[model samples]
Target: MRGYAIRKAMQPHRLTLKVWAVAGSFFGSLCFVLFQGGKLALMLFVIVSILSIYLLLGKWSGIRKTAGSRQLMNAEHETTIEAGSSLNVSMHLQIPGIWPIPYVFVKERLFHKNNTEYTYEVTLVPDWKRRGIFEYKTHPLRRGFYTFGKTECVTEDIFGLFEHTGYIELPQQVAVLPQIVPIREWHQFHQMMKGTNHHSTTTRAVRETTQINGVREYIYGDRLSRIHWNATAKTGTWKSKEFERESLPKTFVVLDRHSQGYTEDEQFELAVSVCASLFHYGASRSFALGLVSGGAASQFFEPKHGQQHLKAVTQHLIGVEADGTYPLRRILKEYVQNVAPGSFVTVISPEHGESMLAVLHWLKQLQLNPCHIFVSADPQRKEHWLKSLKSAGFVGYAVSSLAELPVMLGGRS
Candidate 1:
């Protein structure tokens, strides 16, 4: 809360200046009376001196409100910053009046957890524009959120006889991002990848491969092994099967939401960390990766590749809002038509049973091999949950602790 105390035209020293001038005049008048010959001349001089003082006082009092009422202009809050990076604050102040205030002083109060205030002052020079912008950029030495307290502006009277302090309630907040620790080698991810490969291998030969998903007239170079005998016999023409080249797989990552899965803040950080790491991994491996958040609106990013795509995915993850009640199945169902068959998909969540089963069902429909990474705040439940994922056609890896993420993704990407 901010309070403003305006001492408008309240001159505490007006009497002092007036008293000094009166005393001078009285003494001069008395001296002229004693001198006799020059009495009238000295009296005239005293009268002139009194008029000069009155004019001086009028000149001093002439300062009207030079600027408008001073108030906080705007405040900005940001979530991400380097650990030691600066939080730049640009304050807008409205001062009224034509009074020529020589200078305006702005004091920024930064409040700490201990209830201590760190003050920094800057002098704003007056411009013809009347409005002043005081800008300051200071590095946050410590991590966590810091609140910018009220700002005080002090201005002095034209005669410098008194000082006025006005407070502006410009509260601001900023969060410093933790330093990024990259994953070194993707060994753990490689292990999970191996499991997916193993699961996919068994089902590979069960489905017949075809190009353009249909039979075509056999060409001269067509291999005898590819002849679609049933189709050829029905049409009375030689038809051969054509299979698509073994292209890179498209991977869609679905993040699960559950109210009691973890604390709200923890889920947010974990989601960002995992998304960034996975996007980096997929980009390096030339896999088309998509990200979907489970919620009412069903936010989805279609599978894409390259640096721009990775950035887009990571940005979405950073901005992802958690709504724990939304079912993971709902999002998968919305994208079912868009998801290609046989594409490798991965789902991450702390949820088990229904949530895990939803991902498996989506995979079944797409004919995709899927991996599940269950993130739990509880350490003891990690392995048990991972094992449960394996039973559900997903090779699950659990994140028991937050710090283990860098190692889990294998080192720097």
Candidate 2:
């Protein structure tokens, strides 16, 4: 591959001396014979002979000089940049003296992972002694991995009669991450939960395990094991431990990875932006945030807080793709079980399928606070689904567009 690219870059001008020389010689020879040996024929013969000799020797030497020096010419470039960013490039030629190339062509081929291509070309000053610096910037049309293949340098003879091109084996890459937008906070996510205070066992990790702050009437989902036998026997009523709110509460943002979900690029991207924004807000609020998604390439990040944690989540979100084979409900159900119960749960999905409905029902049964966000949900298609969720007392938000996400989120605050 390297050799092929280099060879292509080193190709000469489209027009060659041999072709023009041959035509000139042929016409000269034919005219000489047709003229029947006159002075004009002699003059034509002399001119043709001189032209042929110069073409053969002079042009050959020029080609050789370029071809030989090409080995010493190196091209390099900085490859990575954001989707709409710039690149810096440099090329060095170590052939001694400032050789004048009236027109030196440098072209680069950029290929996206989607098999689409972008070609960039530029002309350099012929008077270069050692190095040339070029700044190349472009706005990529789409997001994905981009490859910068070999740089092709086309150096032609002084007369511009022929071109000698040499390819520089410079292979680089640039990754354009997906465009992320602010999602703010899920409207009324925390307020809708039964309890306004976010509590966890760690709040009093230093306190005695036997020290139960108080007993709350046991809900159906409360751990059967948590039933305080002493209290139950004394009061003739089921009771459970209720810990105080922790210093830092945790929220699990589960991105739906169901294979059948988010089939559309636009909808999926919007969903991703929502997740990313929620993570951003979590970091700002100093809330320990965790990410959960399931598929063949499932990614699970335990609830964490701080700048480093935020960076980790952002990096993961940048590369996350909705190609999971599992359903959102399955992914959420599995992930939620591992996280601390009685904590906050947020599900972001573009699909409003039965799987989500089942997950919601299960979450309520477990007494886990649940918030479902519909990404780019169409009113006509998801109106019934939204109505049903509301009727069940589960307040859900259906964001028809990205612009509405912030408005709805801010309103809830």
Best by lDDT: 2
**Judged by lDDT against the true structure, how good is candidate 2?**
0.63
Candidate 1: residue 69 Cα off by (Å): 20
**Model 1 regions more than 4 Å off:** 1-180, 187-246, 257-262, 361-366, 391-393, 400-402, 410-413
lDDT of 2 by residue, 1-413 (tens): 99998777655433444566667776767677577788777777777676555444533333223311111112223333433344444444332234444565778777876577888887765444434444454543444566777677676655556555566665666655545555534447544332435244322233224545566566454556667788888999887664433444467888886657765777777777678778776665446788886767888898987889887776676666678886666676577766556667788887665767788878877777777888765677667767877887775777766666777676641
What C-alpha lDDT does candidate 1 achieve relative to the native structure? 0.60
User: Best by TM-score, which number?
Assistant: 2
The whole-model lDDT of each prediction reads: 0.60, 0.63
Candidate 1 displacement at residue 205 in angstroms: 22
lDDT at position 316, candidate 1: 55
At residue 345, candidate 2 shows an lDDT of 77
Residue-wise C-alpha lDDT for candidate 1, range 1-413, written one tens digit per residue: 12332343334467566557666766676666667647576667667566545444533432232233222222223544544456666666666655556777878887744465678889987677567877776645333455677677787644554455676774655444432445535554444445444665442222334544456556454567778899999999998764532444566787765455557656555755676677776665445678877653456788877889976665555445455575666566767556666666677776766657776766776777676766777766776676676676565566755467666555331
Q: Looking at model 1, which ten-residue stretch has the lowest summed lDDT?
A: 67-76
